[model samples]
Target: MKIAITADIHLKQSKDEAPERYNALINIIKKIKDEKIDKLIIAGDLFDKEAKNYNIFDEFVKINNDITFYVIPGNHDVGLNQKYFTANNLQIFNSAQVLSFNNNAIKIFLIPYSADNSMGEVLAQNEQQLPEKWVLLGHGDYITGQSTPNPYEPGIYMLLTRHDIETYNPVKVILGHIHKREIFGKVHYVGSPCGLDITETGKRYFTIVDTNSGEVTSNKILTDILYYNENLIMLPVEDEFGYIEQQIQKMIKGWSLSDDELTKVRLRLKINGYTSDLKKLQSIVNDALKNFTFYNDKEPDLTEVNVLKDNERIQIIELVKEAIEKNDKELGLLQLTQNDVMEQSLHIILNKA
Candidate 1:
C-alpha cells in the first residue's frame, strides 16, 4: 500500500504574499494524484485558523477529491467558541477512533487531540485486532523533552512523547505538529509542506511511505520554491553612507532578484555602524528592491530592519555575562570569581562597538 503523508499546509486566503507557497502546494497535490497513492494523510494544521475561510476547505477538497483523505484537528483548527466545517473526503478524527479500510488493504488507527486522556491509555483502550499492515496517524510532539502544548490548548495540554509510540508499536507512526522534519524509531514528523513564515527557512518537504510485505519505506519530497536571504552589514566606523549603499547594490546584483520580483521579495537587512544614520541604509535596501524588480514596475519591499545602538551591544554583553555566571553557579562552581576568571573559564562575549 502506498501512502502520502503531509502536514502544516497553512493555506491562507491572502495571495499577494504567499503565491509561491500556494502554487507549490497545488503542484504537490498533482504529484500525489499522479503517484496513485492509496491513502493521503494530512496529520494536522490543515487550516491556519477556524475563521470564516470556508473557501480554503473548498479549494483543498477540489484538489484531493479522488483520494481518501484522513485529517486530525490541530490546535489551529479548534476555536474557543466557534464551529468550522471539514470537507467531504476528509475524515476528521477529533476523538480516539480506529478507522479501518479493509477493502483497500489499509488500516488506520486515528488518535486525535484529547485533553483529559493520557496518550498511552488511549492507545491501550483503542487497541484492536490489526491487519497485515497498519499506520498510526496523529499530530503531537514525538520527543520527550520537546513536548510543548499548542498555542490554543484550550486549558488542556494534550501532548505525546516517544514512550507513547513505543507502547503502541505500529508499523509506521506518521505524525505532525513539530515543524522540523525528523525520524525517530518508527515515528516520523514529515514537517511542514512549505515555508509558512520566516521562522520556517531552509528546505521544506513531505514524505511518501510505501507499505509492502509488512515493511515501510519512506521517501522525502522537497517542495519549497521561495528562498529567504538575510544580510548583516557591519559598516566601517568612518565609512561614508554612499559606500554602504554601493555595498548593498553590489550584494543585490549577485542575487537572482529583479525589480518586478522586488515587490514580492521578502528580505531582511541588518546594518551596524558607528553613525546613527539609518535612513541611508533603508533607502539603499529599498533601492535594491526597486532595481531588482525595476523591469516589472514593482516597488522594492523591505521586510525588516535591525539597527544596533551603541548601548544595545554593551547590554547584550552584560546579559551574556550574567547568564554565564548563573549557569556556573547552577553547575556547582560557586567559588569562581573575577570577570577575567569567568572569561577564561567560560567564553567572554565581546561587544563590537
Candidate 2:
C-alpha cells in the first residue's frame, strides 16, 4: 500500500490570507493524483482556525473527492471551542477512539489529538495489542531530546516519545504539529506541507510511505513554494557593500517575487578593514534599495564594528563618525559607550567632529 502523508495545510478561501498555502495544497493533491497514490493521510491543522466557512471546505472537497482522506484535529482546528463535525468522505478524528479500516490487506488506525479524558486511559489499556503493519496517524508534539518550547498549548502538552514508539511498535508512526521536518526512531513528522509564515521557510515537502513486504519505505516529494534563507555576513570595509549587494542579488535571482509580495531580508555587516573611499559603500546600498522591492537594511551599531589592527584606532574613529552621520545610532552607541578604551577614543572623535 502506498500512502502520501502531509500536514499543516491551513486552507482558507480568502486570497489575501493564505492564498499561497491553499495553492500549494492544491498543487500537491494534483501531483498525488498524477502519481496514483493509494491512501492520503493528513496528520492535522487542516484549517487555520475553527470558523464555519463551508465554501472553503466545499472547495477542498472538490479537489480531493477522489482519494480517501483521514485527518485528526490540530490545536488550531479545536481552538477555544471544540467544533468537531463531519464533512463528505473526510473523517475528522477528534478523540482517542480506535478507527479500524477492516480491509483484508491494509488495516489503518486513525488517532487524532486527544483530550485529557481519553489519552491516558486509551494508552494504558491498549498499549499491548497494536495491529501489525498498521499506521498511527495523529498531530502532537513528540517528547524527544530535541523538543523545544511551544506556545500553542498553554499548560497541557502531548508527546509521542521514543519509549511510546518502542512500546506500541507500529510499522510507521506519521504525525504533525511540529513545523520543521524531523525523523526520530520509526516515527516521522511530515511537517507543514506548505510554508505558513516566514518561520516556516525551508525546503517544504511531503512524505510517501510504501508499505510492502511488511516494511515501510519513505520518500520525500519537494513542493513548489517560496522560502527565505537568512544570512549574516561580515566583511572588510572594502568588501562590505559588495558583499551585501551580492547577497541580495542571490536571493532574488531565478526567484519570482510577485508585486505587493513581501520577502524579509535581514543583513548585518561588520566592517573591519580600511577602505580609501568610504562613500563607495553608499553606491552599493543605493543599488540594493533600487533593485529590491521589500527588504530591511540593518547595518551594525558602532560597538559591533571590529577594529582589526591595534594601530588603526584613528581609522576606526573616522568610521564611527561616518556611521553617526548616517544616523546608524545603534552602531554609534556601541562604539562610544561599550568600553573605556573605545569610549574615550570615540568621545574625542565625537567632540572633534
Candidate 3:
C-alpha cells in the first residue's frame, strides 16, 4: 500500500491572507489523487487552532472522497472535536491508539498530542505491544542520540526519546511538532506543507512510504504563496559613489524574481567607504526592485575613515562620502535632500554653501 504523509497544515481563515493556505493544501491533495495514492495521513497540527469553520473543512473532505484520511490532533488542535470533520472516510485519532489497514499488511501505533496526559507514559505502556511490521506516528518533542527536555516544551507535555522507539523497533517512525523537515535515525519529522513564516524559506514536501518494501520517499512541490530570501553583501572602503551604485544594481539583478510570484527580499550591506550623496543613493536602490517587498539594512564603518590623518574639515567630507557610498541600503526612506548629522556637520564647515 502507498501512503502519503504530511504535517502542520496550519489551516486558518484570515482577512489579510486570501485563503491561499487552504488552496495550497488542495493542490497537494490533487497531486495525491493524480498519483493514485491509497491513503493520506496528516501526522499532526491539521489546523493552526481549534478549527471553527466546520463547513469549509466538510467541503474539503467531500471533494476528496476517493482517499481515506487519517488525522491526529496536534498541540494546536488540542480539544478539537471529531464532529468538526463529518466525513465517513476520515479517521480522527484524538489520543494514542492502534490502526490496522490492508488486511493486516500494516499496523500504525498512532500517538496524538494531548495537553492533559504525558506522551512518555502513553508510549511506555503501548510501545512494547507494537507488532513486528508497524509504523509509529506521533506528535511531541522527540530527542535523539541523548534525551533531554526540549526548551520549548517546558511543562505542556512530555517528550519522547529516539531510544524509546528503538526498543520497540518499529519499521518506520513519522512524527510532527517541529516545523522543519528532519530525519533522526529511523524517524522523520515531515515539516509543514507550506511556509508558515518568513524564515520557512525553502521548498516543502510530503513523504510517501511504500508498505511492502518499507521504503520512504518524498514528493517535492513548488510553493506559490509567501516566499522569503535574505542576503548580506559587503562594500569596500575605497569604492567610489558610482561603483557603489553599480555594485548595488549588480546584487539586485542577481535575484531572480518570478513575474507571477510575490516574494519578499531582504538585503544588508556593510559599507567601508564614504560617498557624498547618501539620500540620492537610497532612491536609486528603491526604484530598481520589482515584484519584491524590499528591505535593506546598511551600516557605515567609521573605524577606517576615522583612522585617516586628515583635517577636521576633510574628515567631515570623508564622512559624508561614506554615507553616500553606503546609500540606498535601508527600505522606506526616499527623501533626497534630508541631511544626516554628518551631512549637517559638512554644511557647517562649508558655511551652507
Candidate 4:
C-alpha cells in the first residue's frame, strides 16, 4: 500500500498569508484524492502559533472525508489537546502512538512534539518491539551533523540523535519543523509542504512511502505561487545578448509551466555587472518575457547597471583593479571613485616598475 506524507503546513487564519498557504493545501489534498490515496499523514505543525481556527480546518476535512489525515502535534501546536479541534477523518496523535497497517505487516510510530522529553525517551519501551519493517513519524529537531534548529525559532524541541535512529532503526524516519528538505541516510526531513514564507524558495514536495516495497519517494507539488528571485549577471562579450536572453529563457523553462500556469509565476530580476548597452539589456528582457509579474509590480530597472565600451580596455582596467584589490579589497583606505582608484592603482604600478 502507498501512503502520502507531508508536514509543517503552518496553517493560520486572519493573516495576510492565509490564502497563499491555504490554497496550496487545497491543491495538495486534491492531488491526493485524485491519486486515490486514502491515507495522508501529516508529520506536524498543521497550525501556526495558537491561531485556533478549528472550523476552517474542520470544513476542509469534512469536504475531503474520503482521505484520512493522520496528524501529530508539532512544537507550535503541542497544546492541541487543550483545543476543541473536532473533525471527521482527522486523527490528531497527541501522544506516543503506533498505527498498524496491512495486517501487522507495517508499523508507523507516531511521536508527537514534547518539550521535556527526547524522541528516544518516548520510544524507549518500543525499542524491543520495533518491527522488522517500520517507519517513524515525528515533529521536532533531529540532532545530527547536518541537522539545525528551526531558523525561525532557534531552540531545542524533542531532539532526535543518531543513537535514536540506531536503536529504534525504523525503515524510514520522516520529520517536520525544518522547512528545507534534507536527507541524512534514513532520516528524512519532509520539510514544509508548501512555501509558507517568501524566503522559503523552490518547488515543494510530499513524500510517498510504499509499505509493500519498503521504498520512500517524493512527488513534487507545484502550487499557485512560483516565485523566482534572480540576479541576471551581464557580460562584456560581443555576443552577450544571447547569454542574457538564455538566462531569462532558462528560468522560464525551469518553472515547467503549462499554458494555464503561465500567469502563476512572479519574477524579481536584478541586473548586475557590465553590459554592452543598459537600455538594450532591458529591451532584451522585455522582448523575452511574455507575462510574468515583476517583483513589486514594478518593471526591472537597469539604469544603474554598468555599460561596457571596449572589451580590451575593460581587461586592462580589470587587471589594475585586481592588483589594487589585493591590498585594499573593500577600498577602505580612502573614498575613491572608479577613475580615482584606477589612476591611483596605475601610479603605484608605475612607481613599482
Top-scoring candidate (TM-score): 4
**Per-prediction RMSD in angstroms?**
9.0, 9.1, 9.9, 7.6
lDDT of 1 by residue, 173-283 (tens): 777776667777677777777766554544556677665533444443445343344443333224435655665766565554444434444444444333345566666
**Model 2 worst lDDT run, 10 consecutive residues:** 264-273
lDDT of 4 by residue, 14-83 (tens): 5455576777777778787788888998888888986766778877887888888888888888877524
lDDT at 344, model 1: 44
Clashing pairs in 4: none
lDDT of 3: 0.64
Task: Give per-residue CA lDDT, model 2, range 1-353, as digits (tens).
Answer: 56777887777646467566766666667777888974577777777774556466555654567877767777667541233333465665655545454454444556666555333345556655556656676677777677544444444445566676676666777777877777777777787876665456555678776655334444433444445534332234344566556645655552444432333332232332233334554456446656332213444323333333333654565575345446546656666422233344454643532
TM-score of model 4 (CA atoms): 0.79
Window of ten residues with lowest summed lDDT in model 1: 344-353
* Alpha-carbon TM-score of each model against the true structure: 0.60, 0.67, 0.69, 0.79
Which candidate's lDDT is highest?
Answer: 4
Ordered by TM-score, highest first, the candidates read 4, 3, 2, 1
**Looking at candidate 2, what is the lDDT of residue 324?**
48
Ranking by lDDT: 4, 3, 1, 2
Badly placed stretches (over 4 Å) of model 2 are 13-16, 79-87, 97-106, 117-121, 148-156, 213-225, 241-353
What is the TM-score of candidate 1? 0.60
Please state the error at residue 43 of candidate 3 in Å.
Answer: 1.5
User: How does model 2 score by TM-score?
Assistant: 0.67
Give one digit per residue, the lDDT tens place, for model 3 in 36-115: 98588888888877466756766777778898888998887876667877788788887778777775566778888876
Please provide the root mean square deviation of candidate 4 (C-alpha atoms, Å): 7.6
